[model samples]
Target: GSWHPETGGLHEAFGDITAILTMISQMDQCEAIICHSKGDLHAKTYFSAVAEEFGYALYGRTQGLRNADNDLTMSQVTEEVHDISQVFTGAFYDILADIFEDYCCPEKYDAAETLFRIGKHITSLLLQALLKGPSSNATFSDIAKLMISLEPKKKWKDMIRRQFSVRGVVGKGAKKVKAPVDLVWGGCHCS
Candidate 1:
């Protein structure tokens, strides 16, 4: 079967996700700490824990990632990561340009730019959390605490804390549904 961008077997999808995370860890200098002395064993353990804890927080699923059967050499991994990064950057900008063209409005342009900046900020905070946490057995709570501490605004810090406190509770409390809801579309929805 041909490879599809949106769907794949669980193992295949997990492998690709792990590869991307591995590359990111390498870029953020986490690979060095995880691979110190213990090599692939430590890397596997660290990444497995990260995938499980971080994955559960984000998706409410604990993925038990296994060690790569054929681990790439350090140099090889570095080269592959570099290539992947280049391809990803090029594709990202191309998509962004297409999006800007499709939604040609000053307000939409500002919103898109703001979204990109927010994504970058979140990525930086994740990397910072990884850097500050323990080399092995770093839980999501550790990362969340780091984020709370790093957040400048008290309101945002409180929000982060609240979010972390309810990591996996899916709709724990019932919400009051208001009757006769009004749907207002202010020229934003395409006719």
Candidate 2:
């Protein structure tokens, strides 16, 4: 549950502190809680003070996480963020490792890791394109062509009917296809 301040400055902070304090008083009865913020000292201090009140022991993990029994501080969260970054960085550095492996006889793991990153990037790009809308110039014909081009050949007849609403085909004084065909075939013998 989130509570917003009706009117006041740091008084809201006091209110938040009070609410958290009340919640932490019963921390033993609860399993865990997740708190999100912009990593400010005010919030960190509030949680630290509340944890201390609850007699929850805070421990620092080698992974850079600071845990207070069932709760985690932003410092601990930062550690997890760092771990993810390391993974991304390793994926990047693997490109150089691949070159060294083929040209300078390095480990095969490097090439495999680099290939994984390349594959991931390709899939992510395609996923993003699908999630986002079509391009500015995408028309009914373009989309129809794309659907037909895909494997298994999806029949989009209904989609075409709904999309293509042909109107204004018979302009002013336009008789019909039969009349035009007759005129073309008879030639200009009378005229």
Using TM-score as the measure, which candidate wins? 1
lDDT of 2 by residue, 58-153 (tens): 343231232111222112222233322222122212222222223322254432333333334323322343334244322222222232233131
TM-score of each: 0.34, 0.16
Q: For residues 1-191, what per-residue lDDT tens digits would candidate 1 score against the true structure? A: 12211111212323433453443333333334224413232233433233455456766655432222222221222223322222222222222223323333546444334334333544565457658865543333445568667766575555555544443211232122113223455666667
Error of 1 at 8 (Å): 21
Task: Using lDDT, give the best candidate's number.
Answer: 1
Clashing pairs in 1: none
The number of clashing residue pairs in model 2 is 1
Cα displacement (Å) at residue 13, model 1:
13
lDDT of each: 0.37, 0.26
Query: How well does candidate 2 match the true structure in TM-score terms?
Result: 0.16
